[model samples]
Target: MPRLFQVIGRQEPVATVSMTVYLHATSADYAAVGDDYLLVDSRGARGGRGFYDQHATIWSRDGRLLVTTQQVVWYRVTK
Candidate 1:
């Protein structure tokens, strides 16, 4: 299994917001394969005169990374 950690947290909404992630994990046994690495995921939102962002990282079994994904979502709120 992989280990996941949240590097960022949600904040207030604003005009614009950005989230960044850095994958820097290493493994000895798993690192033997090229598919070994760290996976980072990030998300953010802007609304209500503020913005919020969050990030998460997941490593594969033996602390290796083989799969990766990215998702961006936007929503408009009327208040």
Candidate 2:
């Protein structure tokens, strides 16, 4: 799991957790592309100290599913 959490620097995650996307719905089909409005919704949670997780979904104006993503992150503050 460290392979998934490590990205940029040498920072390490002492604790971590995973989350799943709850809902993703679409109304219309956007197979033919031209121009359309994109909508997004997201929600997340934090352990209040070391880690947080979030997921988001993007949809076209006609309610076509465009993209969805979820991520877990570990962070620290230093000066």
* TM-score of candidate 2 versus the correct structure, residues matched by position: 0.49
lDDT of each: 0.38, 0.57
| C-alpha TM-scores of all predictions | 0.32, 0.49
Sliding window of 10 residues with minimal summed lDDT for model 1? 1-10
- Cα lDDT of candidate 1 equals 0.38
Model 2, 3-76: lDDT tens digits are 32343345454444554554455334444434756787765644346566767787777666767877676655
Q: Provide the lDDT at 79 for model 1.
A: 39
Candidate 2: RMSD to truth: 6.7
Runs of candidate 1 with Cα error greater than 4 angstroms are 1-16, 26-49, 64-75
Number of backbone collisions per candidate: 8, 0
